[model samples]
Target: MPELPEVEITRLGLMPLINHKVSQVVIRNSSLRWPVNLALNSILKDMPLVGLQRRGKYIFASFPIGTLIIHLGMSGRLCIASKKSAVQKHDHVDIIFNGPENKILRYRDPRRFGSITWTEDDPYQHKLIMSLGPEPLDNEFSADYLYEKLRNKSVCIKNAIMNSHVVVGVGNIYASESLFQARVQPHRPAHKISKDEIKSIVDAIKDVIENAINKGGSTLNDFFDVDGKSGYFQNEHHVYARKGMPCYLCDHPILQITLGQRSSFYCKNCQK
Candidate 1:
């Protein structure tokens, strides 16, 4: 699934489509995770996409009338397509813009797990996104706030941080890398971690996420930018997917364990 960095990259790459009027919406196949609205054409007709932004993993294409929310589920991607481009298999939604450029934003998802939804009201208040945790890179996700959130929580540190309510966009791959960088064992109880250690984890989370974004995000599976560019962050990973390999810091072998049904890679000698 595309995480925060990948989503942000998608948003940035699609900036050219912003401020363009929606001439038409072509829903080739509406049977996504949630049905693509059949009335999108009528709803978005002539509405200019005034703002393009991302929150967590969702991209919000804002217009004066309302906003269109897009989630690139487990295997979804948006590409800038020409007006005359051929329609391929699994091509779902197409928002054709009315401008001199004559461009189209095509959404393709092999798994059909993505969604395209619209709301006339504030999208931030929508039930789908209202309950989400603070953005990991924002000021609300500070070490003190994280400490307060984890207090008395007996869940394992990895699971706790991975919790959407605790911090948004800390996916399995980045979580492992962040914990490894923070020198904390993934299975350690959240409450057992000291405040100093929590601070380190907080810093590690921000550093790991920023670094991943700088590298265009990890291309573990089908992740790609809006321009079909591959992310190279996976190559710089310290422990993720290096299960039995030698640790980069210490000579001890990196270990892999299953926690919360997700594979966690860590250096036993380096990460305590």
Candidate 2:
């Protein structure tokens, strides 16, 4: 699944082409759980795209009428391509723009988990966006907020941070990497962790996310930038997916554990 950094990077990549351009919205395949074409066409036909932004893992395209909210579920990605290019498989949604350069933006989701919807008043009022916590990069997600949220919580630190209610878009892979960077054991109880450790965890989250954005996000399989290039963050993994391999820092065997049914990787000697 694409996280916040991945989604933000996509928004940035798309802003130049789609912003201020009148879009020709086409929802090719909307037969999924939620029929998107009808809603998308009805709302986006004449709306000029004002800007592009992200909240958590969702991408928001502002328009005159409303906001277009996109969620790249487990295996979904949004790509930008030329209008004349031959459509690829699973190219569900296409938003074409007749700019001076004549470019086309496409949304291709092979797994069909991605979705498109429109919101009039506030996108957050939408059911999917309503319950999400603050963006991980926001000031609201400071160390004090994290410490207060984890107070008296008995869940493991990894699970605590991955909770969307605590903070958005700390997915399994990034969570493990951030924990390892902060030297926090994955299985440590949340409340038992010190305030200093919480601060470290907050800093680690920001650091890992910034690093991933700089690298264009981890392209484990389906993720790609507007240029259709894979992200380079996976190359900098400190502990994620290196289970049973030598830890980079301590040379100890990198360990793997399951938390909240998600596989977590950390260095047993270095993290704890």
Compute each candidate's TM-score over C-alphas.
0.94, 0.91
lDDT of each prediction vs. the true structure? 0.86, 0.79
Per-residue lDDT tens digits of candidate 1, residues 117-236?
A: 888899999888999999988989988998999989999999999998788899998899999999999999999999999999999999988887876633422343344553334558
Off by over 4 Å in 2: 37-39, 217-227, 230-232
Q: Output the number of the TM-score-best candidate.
A: 1
Question: For candidate 2, lDDT tens digit of each residue in 1-272?
Answer: 77777777777777666554655777789854466857666566666788787888888888877887888776677776775578877888888776666566788777887788777878878888889888888899999999999988999999999989889989888999999989999999999999999999999999998888876634422444344643334567888888899997779999888888989998888877
> What is the Cα-based TM-score of model 2?
0.91
- What residue runs in model 1 are displaced by over 4 Å at the alpha carbon? 217-232
Residue 162 lDDT, candidate 2, scale 0-100: 91
Which pairs in model 1 have colliding backbones? none
